[model samples]
Target: MNDTLHVVEKLTEWRARALEFEREIQKAVLGQARVIRLVTICIFARGHVLIEGDVGVGKTTLLRSASRALGGDFARVEGTVDM
Candidate 1:
Protein backbone atom coordinates (compact mmCIF):
# COMPACT_ATOMS: atom_id res chain seq x y z
CA MET A 1 0.00 0.00 0.00
CA ASN A 2 2.75 2.44 0.91
CA ASP A 3 4.65 1.71 -2.31
CA THR A 4 1.55 2.31 -4.39
CA LEU A 5 0.99 5.68 -2.70
CA HIS A 6 4.54 6.70 -3.37
CA VAL A 7 4.23 5.81 -7.03
CA VAL A 8 1.05 7.84 -7.35
CA GLU A 9 2.69 10.85 -5.73
CA LYS A 10 5.62 10.70 -8.13
CA LEU A 11 3.31 10.45 -11.14
CA THR A 12 1.40 13.51 -10.01
CA GLU A 13 4.59 15.48 -9.60
CA TRP A 14 5.79 14.38 -13.03
CA ARG A 15 2.53 15.44 -14.63
CA ALA A 16 2.83 18.89 -13.09
CA ARG A 17 6.32 19.24 -14.41
CA ALA A 18 5.20 18.18 -17.89
CA LEU A 19 2.45 20.79 -17.95
CA GLU A 20 4.88 23.48 -16.88
CA PHE A 21 7.25 22.38 -19.63
CA GLU A 22 4.51 22.62 -22.28
CA ARG A 23 3.69 26.17 -21.23
CA GLU A 24 7.32 27.20 -21.48
CA ILE A 25 7.66 25.78 -25.00
CA GLN A 26 4.45 27.44 -26.14
CA LYS A 27 5.94 30.86 -25.41
CA ALA A 28 8.51 30.56 -28.18
CA VAL A 29 6.73 28.42 -30.77
CA LEU A 30 3.42 30.09 -31.52
CA GLY A 31 0.65 28.64 -33.73
CA GLN A 32 1.82 25.07 -33.11
CA ALA A 33 -0.23 23.83 -30.21
CA ARG A 34 -0.51 20.28 -31.59
CA VAL A 35 3.23 20.01 -32.07
CA ILE A 36 3.87 21.36 -28.61
CA ARG A 37 1.44 18.92 -27.06
CA LEU A 38 2.97 15.99 -28.91
CA VAL A 39 6.43 16.99 -27.77
CA THR A 40 5.27 17.29 -24.20
CA ILE A 41 3.71 13.84 -24.41
CA CYS A 42 6.94 12.41 -25.74
CA ILE A 43 8.86 13.98 -22.87
CA PHE A 44 6.64 12.43 -20.25
CA ALA A 45 6.66 9.03 -21.99
CA ARG A 46 10.45 9.04 -22.21
CA GLY A 47 10.21 8.47 -25.94
CA HIS A 48 12.10 9.81 -28.91
CA VAL A 49 10.56 12.07 -31.53
CA LEU A 50 11.34 12.59 -35.20
CA ILE A 51 10.25 15.87 -36.76
CA GLU A 52 10.14 16.14 -40.52
CA GLY A 53 9.07 19.20 -42.41
CA ASP A 54 10.01 21.41 -45.25
CA VAL A 55 12.60 24.06 -44.72
CA GLY A 56 11.43 27.13 -42.74
CA VAL A 57 8.56 25.34 -41.06
CA GLY A 58 9.88 26.06 -37.56
CA LYS A 59 11.06 22.47 -37.01
CA THR A 60 14.42 23.39 -35.54
CA THR A 61 12.90 26.30 -33.67
CA LEU A 62 10.38 24.01 -32.04
CA LEU A 63 12.99 21.43 -31.00
CA ARG A 64 15.32 24.06 -29.62
CA SER A 65 12.53 25.72 -27.68
CA ALA A 66 11.43 22.38 -26.25
CA SER A 67 14.98 21.50 -25.18
CA ARG A 68 15.40 24.83 -23.41
CA ALA A 69 12.05 24.53 -21.69
CA LEU A 70 12.83 20.98 -20.51
CA GLY A 71 16.38 21.89 -19.46
CA GLY A 72 17.77 19.15 -21.72
CA ASP A 73 20.45 19.07 -24.38
CA PHE A 74 19.44 19.63 -28.02
CA ALA A 75 21.34 18.33 -31.02
CA ARG A 76 20.29 18.59 -34.68
CA VAL A 77 21.65 17.20 -37.92
CA GLU A 78 20.72 18.21 -41.45
CA GLY A 79 21.27 15.81 -44.29
CA THR A 80 20.55 15.72 -48.00
CA VAL A 81 20.81 12.96 -50.60
CA ASP A 82 22.40 13.55 -53.98
CA MET A 83 21.16 11.83 -57.08
Candidate 2:
Protein backbone atom coordinates (compact mmCIF):
# COMPACT_ATOMS: atom_id res chain seq x y z
CA MET A 1 0.00 0.00 0.00
CA ASN A 2 2.77 2.41 0.86
CA ASP A 3 4.60 1.60 -2.42
CA THR A 4 1.46 2.20 -4.46
CA LEU A 5 0.92 5.56 -2.78
CA HIS A 6 4.49 6.57 -3.53
CA VAL A 7 4.10 5.66 -7.16
CA VAL A 8 0.93 7.69 -7.42
CA GLU A 9 2.56 10.69 -5.86
CA LYS A 10 5.48 10.50 -8.27
CA LEU A 11 3.15 10.27 -11.23
CA THR A 12 1.30 13.34 -10.06
CA GLU A 13 4.48 15.32 -9.80
CA TRP A 14 5.56 14.21 -13.25
CA ARG A 15 2.23 15.18 -14.73
CA ALA A 16 2.53 18.65 -13.28
CA ARG A 17 6.01 19.05 -14.68
CA ALA A 18 4.87 17.85 -18.10
CA LEU A 19 2.04 20.38 -18.15
CA GLU A 20 4.42 23.19 -17.27
CA PHE A 21 6.81 22.04 -19.97
CA GLU A 22 4.06 22.10 -22.56
CA ARG A 23 3.09 25.63 -21.57
CA GLU A 24 6.66 26.80 -21.96
CA ILE A 25 6.86 25.30 -25.44
CA GLN A 26 3.58 26.95 -26.33
CA LYS A 27 5.06 30.37 -25.67
CA ALA A 28 7.66 29.80 -28.39
CA VAL A 29 5.44 27.88 -30.78
CA LEU A 30 2.35 29.43 -32.31
CA GLY A 31 -0.66 27.68 -33.77
CA GLN A 32 0.60 24.18 -33.00
CA ALA A 33 -1.08 23.27 -29.76
CA ARG A 34 -1.99 19.74 -30.82
CA VAL A 35 1.51 18.94 -31.94
CA ILE A 36 2.95 20.43 -28.80
CA ARG A 37 0.68 18.29 -26.62
CA LEU A 38 1.64 15.17 -28.55
CA VAL A 39 5.29 15.96 -28.07
CA THR A 40 4.75 16.51 -24.37
CA ILE A 41 3.00 13.17 -24.04
CA CYS A 42 5.84 11.47 -25.87
CA ILE A 43 8.36 13.03 -23.54
CA PHE A 44 6.43 11.96 -20.45
CA ALA A 45 6.12 8.43 -21.82
CA ARG A 46 9.86 8.21 -22.47
CA GLY A 47 9.18 7.47 -26.11
CA HIS A 48 10.92 8.64 -29.28
CA VAL A 49 9.13 10.70 -31.86
CA LEU A 50 9.57 11.10 -35.60
CA ILE A 51 8.05 14.38 -36.77
CA GLU A 52 7.25 14.77 -40.44
CA GLY A 53 5.95 17.89 -42.05
CA ASP A 54 6.39 20.12 -45.02
CA VAL A 55 9.42 22.33 -45.24
CA GLY A 56 9.11 25.50 -43.12
CA VAL A 57 6.43 23.91 -41.00
CA GLY A 58 8.35 24.55 -37.76
CA LYS A 59 9.51 20.98 -37.13
CA THR A 60 12.94 22.07 -35.98
CA THR A 61 11.51 24.95 -34.07
CA LEU A 62 9.13 22.65 -32.24
CA LEU A 63 11.89 20.36 -31.02
CA ARG A 64 14.15 23.24 -30.12
CA SER A 65 11.39 24.95 -28.22
CA ALA A 66 10.60 21.81 -26.25
CA SER A 67 14.26 21.23 -25.48
CA ARG A 68 14.68 24.78 -24.27
CA ALA A 69 11.60 24.46 -22.11
CA LEU A 70 12.90 21.24 -20.56
CA GLY A 71 16.39 22.71 -20.15
CA GLY A 72 17.84 19.96 -22.32
CA ASP A 73 20.01 19.90 -25.44
CA PHE A 74 18.51 19.68 -28.89
CA ALA A 75 20.14 18.42 -32.07
CA ARG A 76 18.93 18.23 -35.63
CA VAL A 77 20.14 15.96 -38.43
CA GLU A 78 19.62 16.55 -42.13
CA GLY A 79 19.60 13.87 -44.78
CA THR A 80 21.40 14.30 -48.05
CA VAL A 81 22.07 12.12 -51.04
CA ASP A 82 25.64 11.95 -52.29
CA MET A 83 26.30 10.67 -55.78
Candidate 3:
Protein backbone atom coordinates (compact mmCIF):
# COMPACT_ATOMS: atom_id res chain seq x y z
CA MET A 1 0.00 0.00 0.00
CA ASN A 2 2.81 2.43 0.87
CA ASP A 3 4.64 1.67 -2.38
CA THR A 4 1.53 2.23 -4.49
CA LEU A 5 0.91 5.54 -2.75
CA HIS A 6 4.49 6.61 -3.38
CA VAL A 7 4.19 5.75 -7.07
CA VAL A 8 0.99 7.74 -7.42
CA GLU A 9 2.55 10.70 -5.66
CA LYS A 10 5.55 10.64 -7.97
CA LEU A 11 3.32 10.45 -11.03
CA THR A 12 1.30 13.41 -9.87
CA GLU A 13 4.43 15.42 -9.29
CA TRP A 14 5.70 14.55 -12.76
CA ARG A 15 2.45 15.61 -14.35
CA ALA A 16 2.65 19.00 -12.71
CA ARG A 17 6.27 19.38 -13.79
CA ALA A 18 5.40 18.47 -17.35
CA LEU A 19 2.70 21.14 -17.45
CA GLU A 20 5.16 23.75 -16.22
CA PHE A 21 7.67 22.65 -18.85
CA GLU A 22 5.07 22.98 -21.63
CA ARG A 23 4.24 26.49 -20.49
CA GLU A 24 7.91 27.48 -20.49
CA ILE A 25 8.36 26.17 -24.03
CA GLN A 26 5.31 28.10 -25.18
CA LYS A 27 6.71 31.27 -23.67
CA ALA A 28 10.11 30.84 -25.30
CA VAL A 29 8.83 29.69 -28.69
CA LEU A 30 6.28 32.20 -29.86
CA GLY A 31 4.10 31.48 -32.93
CA GLN A 32 5.73 28.11 -33.64
CA ALA A 33 3.97 25.75 -31.32
CA ARG A 34 3.46 23.18 -34.05
CA VAL A 35 7.12 23.11 -34.91
CA ILE A 36 7.96 22.87 -31.24
CA ARG A 37 5.57 19.97 -30.83
CA LEU A 38 7.11 18.12 -33.78
CA VAL A 39 10.56 18.67 -32.35
CA THR A 40 9.42 17.50 -28.97
CA ILE A 41 8.00 14.34 -30.53
CA CYS A 42 11.24 13.69 -32.33
CA ILE A 43 13.28 14.05 -29.18
CA PHE A 44 10.87 11.92 -27.25
CA ALA A 45 11.19 9.22 -29.88
CA ARG A 46 15.00 9.49 -29.97
CA GLY A 47 15.01 10.45 -33.66
CA HIS A 48 16.97 12.98 -35.68
CA VAL A 49 15.39 15.94 -37.46
CA LEU A 50 16.24 17.52 -40.80
CA ILE A 51 14.86 21.00 -41.13
CA GLU A 52 14.67 22.21 -44.74
CA GLY A 53 14.41 25.90 -45.38
CA ASP A 54 16.03 28.78 -47.17
CA VAL A 55 18.50 31.07 -45.54
CA GLY A 56 17.29 33.50 -42.86
CA VAL A 57 14.11 31.49 -42.33
CA GLY A 58 14.70 30.86 -38.57
CA LYS A 59 15.94 27.28 -39.07
CA THR A 60 19.06 27.77 -37.02
CA THR A 61 17.20 29.79 -34.42
CA LEU A 62 14.58 27.09 -34.04
CA LEU A 63 17.10 24.25 -33.78
CA ARG A 64 19.23 26.19 -31.34
CA SER A 65 16.26 27.09 -29.22
CA ALA A 66 15.15 23.48 -29.18
CA SER A 67 18.59 22.33 -28.18
CA ARG A 68 18.73 24.83 -25.35
CA ALA A 69 15.36 23.81 -24.11
CA LEU A 70 16.30 20.13 -24.29
CA GLY A 71 19.64 20.71 -22.54
CA GLY A 72 21.95 19.40 -25.28
CA ASP A 73 24.69 20.53 -27.62
CA PHE A 74 23.87 22.48 -30.78
CA ALA A 75 26.06 22.91 -33.81
CA ARG A 76 25.62 24.59 -37.20
CA VAL A 77 27.66 24.61 -40.39
CA GLU A 78 27.23 26.55 -43.59
CA GLY A 79 26.87 24.58 -46.82
CA THR A 80 28.69 25.28 -50.07
CA VAL A 81 27.99 24.56 -53.71
CA ASP A 82 30.51 21.73 -53.88
CA MET A 83 29.19 18.19 -53.32
The model with the greatest TM-score is 2
The digit string of per-residue lDDT tens for model 3 on 19-67 reads 5555556765678777766766676567998788778767777877677
Give each model a TM-score: 0.80, 0.81, 0.62
| Comparing 1 and 3 on lDDT, the stronger one | 1
What TM-score should be assigned to candidate 1? Answer: 0.80
Task: Enumerate residue pairs that collide in model 3.
Answer: none
Candidate 1 segments exceeding 4 Å error:
none
Measured over all alpha carbons after superposition, the RMSD of each candidate to the real structure, in angstroms, is 2.1, 2.0, 3.5
Total backbone clashes of model 2?
0
lDDT of 1 by residue, 8-66 (tens): 99999988998888889888888998988898898779899988888898999999999
The CA root-mean-square deviation of candidate 3, after full C-alpha superposition on the true structure, stands at: 3.5
Best by lDDT: 2
Please write out the lDDT profile of model 2 over residues 21-80, one tens digit for every residue.
988998888999999989998988899999998999999999999999978999888865
Separately for all candidates shown, the number of backbone clashes (residues 3 or more apart, or on different chains) is 0, 0, 0
